[model samples]
Target: MRFRKRVLLYLVPAFVIYSAFMLIPLLMSMRVALYEYTGIGDMTFIGLDNFQRLLFESPYADRFINAITNTLEFFLYTMVFQNVTALLLALALTRGLKLTGLFRTIIFIPVTISILMIGFIWTLILNPNIGVLNQFLEVIGLEAWATAWLGNEATALPTVAVVNAWQYTGLMVMLFIAGIQSIPEDRFEAARLDGAKGWNIFRHIIFPAIIPIVGIVTIMTLMGVFNQFDLIYAMVGSTGGPNYAVDLLGTLFYRTAFGGVGGQVPQMGLGAAIATMTFFYDLYVCHRHALY
Candidate 1:
């Protein structure tokens, strides 16, 4: 009984914190999602009307659809360019690179920078008028390639997605590196003795060993990609400007909950509905993937 009491002392703080920060908010959001409530007005219990309107009857259906699709595109881009590239880098680093420590630090530096700062920095770099990128293009006689990266609807979403991928690639790199380091070196030696080289070694040995780590990385990337708001919010503002080119579900929730420059009146209920649905959708995707 004394030992159990001691164990409870250690667990109680964590339980309290989790309940206060995560569990409480999750329950509150689900409850709020069923009501018609603005920030100021009293809430009215409306059953699933908010969800019905959001999915089938909302005037902003088209925009919401676009946001959902854009978010998926962003996730795909990250999976391919960021996570895959990070895995490649980690693999390369394992091939007896000398300055491994320096390289790791340099790669991870961008992740240490604030998301807002990275957005502002990239904004300055990609500016059409006087940005360094355009100037560099002009100097190199590639002026035709220089364009307003964030302003043009065609390039805006992809550009922001790439920017976000760039910032987070280092995190995936570190994850991959850790997985690679934990691998048994004897396995590589055995493969080397069997004349397996290059892609064969990686495919047959290293790749198989890292499947569990890949699952973890995939789930984390899924969560981060789905919940992405900071970088887009910082770069494109709350409105997701230039014709909502880079709008995401996160931004949609924010815009709905709080009226923006060119948005509708506060629809806190609808915003909560979107939030609740998206949270579960992401959870379901991750859970389904994990189960398989």
Candidate 2:
């Protein structure tokens, strides 16, 4: 009885808080998916019609497909640009370089600011007219290489992806640095005594030890890329402009739910359906990745 009370003492408050904040709202969203209701009156109990339309009908279908396609592409881009680059930077920094603290601080400064702020800052830097990047290119006699980065269809999606990667790479770097630092020093000494050197040492010792961190970083990056919205909205608005080139599921949800685009009438039920799928999708992906 005493042990039960002690367990309940610590667990009850956390359970109550989670139920109020997360579980309740999640249930509400699922319930909302079954009915057609705006923020106004006269909600129609549409059952599965909204979901059918969203999955197989007209405008929603195409946009959902496009958003999903772009989401996957965004993940791929970030995996290469963000995680790989962070690992490289972490490796280099871990090698005991001069001014290591200064460089690490400079790299991590981006992570300290809000994503909204980073988006705005990069928007200004990458602006075609009177932008610093273009001005620098022109000054260096590379004006011919300069183009409208976020404004051009060919470059827009990739540019936005890269910008996100740039902002979050610092976080990945820090995670990797922590992983590297946690490794036992005796392992390195043992490897050296065994006449192992350079790539051989890292291949056998460092990389194997950091596998858990790699999996963690991978899943975190996946979630961030999948749930991306604010940066794209801040940099280019929710339209996912330049021919709807940078669209993702997060932006799609807003447009559908709030009537930001695609239709004059808000499709709250359909939006809820999408949100539900996203939740399940994230859960599944996280579960799979957590195995590593």
TM-score (all chains, Cα) for each model: 0.94, 0.94
lDDT of each: 0.88, 0.89
> What is candidate 1's lDDT per residue for 180-236, written digit by digit as tens?
889898998998899999999888888888888899888888889789999999898
Predictions: Cα RMSD each: 1.7, 1.7
lDDT of 2 by residue, 1-292 (tens): 9999999999999999999999999999998899998857877898887778777988878888889989999899999989999999999999999999999999988888998898888999998997899999999999997999998988888889899888888899999999999999999999999999989988999899999999999889888887899999999888886777898999888878888754557778888988988999999997898664
| Shift of residue 3 alpha carbon in model 2, Å | 1.0
In angstroms, how far off is 149's CA in candidate 1? 0.7
How many clashes show up per model? 0, 0
Stretches of candidate 1 exceeding 4 Å from the true structure: 1-6, 289-292
